[model samples]
Target: MKNGKSPGSDNIPVEIVKVGRHRVIELLRIAFNKCLEEQTIPEIWNCAIVILLHKKEGTGEKAGSDHVRKTNEWLRHQSKVTDVIKRVARLKWEWVGHMARKTDTWSKRLLEWRPWGEKRPRGRPQMRWDDDIRQIAGTRWLQVAQSRDEWRSLKEAYTQVVETG
Candidate 1:
């Protein structure tokens, strides 16, 4: 974008990410940037509240502001975004921050967490790997690893440990 000239019209750049998610990420990025530019946290917070309300719909009017206000009023003792329950994956503070408020609530938290699968502990941050687990995750490598498992064989456990060592 810095340089105006393209190689040619036919040279369309490949999209680095899936279109649907890429659009969402771009929307989020813009929202976060705007929030930062304007310095409004509550604006972002209100947007998230609206999203949460939409995510969880109840019997009737609870789907909208009547019950929402009741819930919000009861929940007003909170100061930060992370205080709310996070069962809903769509409850994205980063998007709210970017689009409405202009600041990321969990900027530090996002940077700190690594992509571990589903179950994450409440507080503790994950280490890169406990040992050299990454050293052999490839298909060919897994076969070697499986065969190397001494636990599979009924032969002397003591002998296997020494051999592995």
Candidate 2:
């Protein structure tokens, strides 16, 4: 729904939709209702197009020159694009720290809640939400997060580590 984003597999740009907002909304509404009634979605809706743009340095280099072709990793390193996983991890850490500081919120309660009747079915225990935090701030991460100043420092350290790593 956001403008300036790449079009989906349908190749319909958001700008076009915006131009015909009322008609588009009505058409989409009918389509959604029909899909729900039939319990079926259009096949094209499941398709996506992923396009990766070359970085400035990567683009300037000749395709068939003597110079070595830059790998995707090298190009990503040189580009300003942020890593999605790193950003998500940083956001998750910040959210966990924020929730940890709350006294009696549902969010905090749910965050600390554990399932009652789960049995092991794997070779190793799955990684947890607070695992990274525990690794960085020790077992007392929640206690550390309680203090505003301490939590801010911890967040900065976490951000630096995520960005670099």
Q: What TM-score, over all chains together, does every model reach?
A: 0.18, 0.49
- Each model's RMSD to truth, in Å? 22.8, 10.9
The window of 10 residues in a row where model 1 has the poorest summed lDDT is 81-90
lDDT for predicted candidate 2 compared with the true structure? 0.72
Model 2: how large is the Cα RMSD against the reference? 10.9
Query: All models: lDDT?
Result: 0.36, 0.72
- Per-residue lDDT of model 1, residues 1-165, tens digit only: 223344333353333233355565666556655655465554435543222434344535644443333454243333222222231111232232233222344753553346767777698766542122222223232233334342123123322332343
Which segments of candidate 2 are over 4 A away from where they belong? 1-79, 116-118, 159-165
Which candidate tops TM-score? 2
lDDT of 2 at 87: 60
The candidate that achieves the highest lDDT relative to the unseen native structure: 2
